[model samples]
Target: LDRRSTFAAEVCGCQVEIGAAGAMGAAAVVEAAGGTALQACDAAATVFQNIMGSVCDLVQGIVEIPCHSRNAALASMAFLCADM
Candidate 1:
């Protein structure tokens, strides 16, 4: 357990979300930080529109191929969406 790290984010994504969780969580954070719900939904929808994880991406029971980059990229994308 010590090997894993912890974060202090406003909200966190879950395993069920797979690919777009980061962006969605980021949107939630923005909303929690005073952004409107519409903004958050727009941000999450934007990120989801860009990239979405799928079961087809799984390989050998591992879904690590693009999740790392996808999550990071999408998380940042949410901010742009919220701003717009």
Candidate 2:
């Protein structure tokens, strides 16, 4: 039980860190493309929604499952959003 709880916490923390990194990436991209950071962030959010497609929350309480993939996807999306 303790290990499970720790895993959950770690997963949650990773998710939060991913979000922050995504935001920063988006800002950088937007700045590079001559767009506003807010607009880039909005685009990133849309990209996230499309990529995740209603699949929210981790299943089996495993962080390595969707969390890892989503984090990577988010980083890519941030770059794409900034370019657009």
Question: Which candidate has the top score in lDDT?
Answer: 2
Query: Residue 9 in model 2: shift from native, Å?
Result: 6.0
Residue pairs clashing in model 2 are none
Compared with the true structure, what per-residue lDDT tens digits does model 1 show for residues 53-73? 333345566556545655666
lDDT of 2 by residue, 1-84 (tens): 134333243544554555556756776777777887578767666554444333446678864677678787788877776666
lDDT of each: 0.56, 0.62
Worst 10 residues of 1 by lDDT: 1-10
Q: How do the predictions measure up, each by TM-score?
A: 0.50, 0.51
- Which ranges of candidate 1 are over 4 A from the true structure? 1-18, 53-63
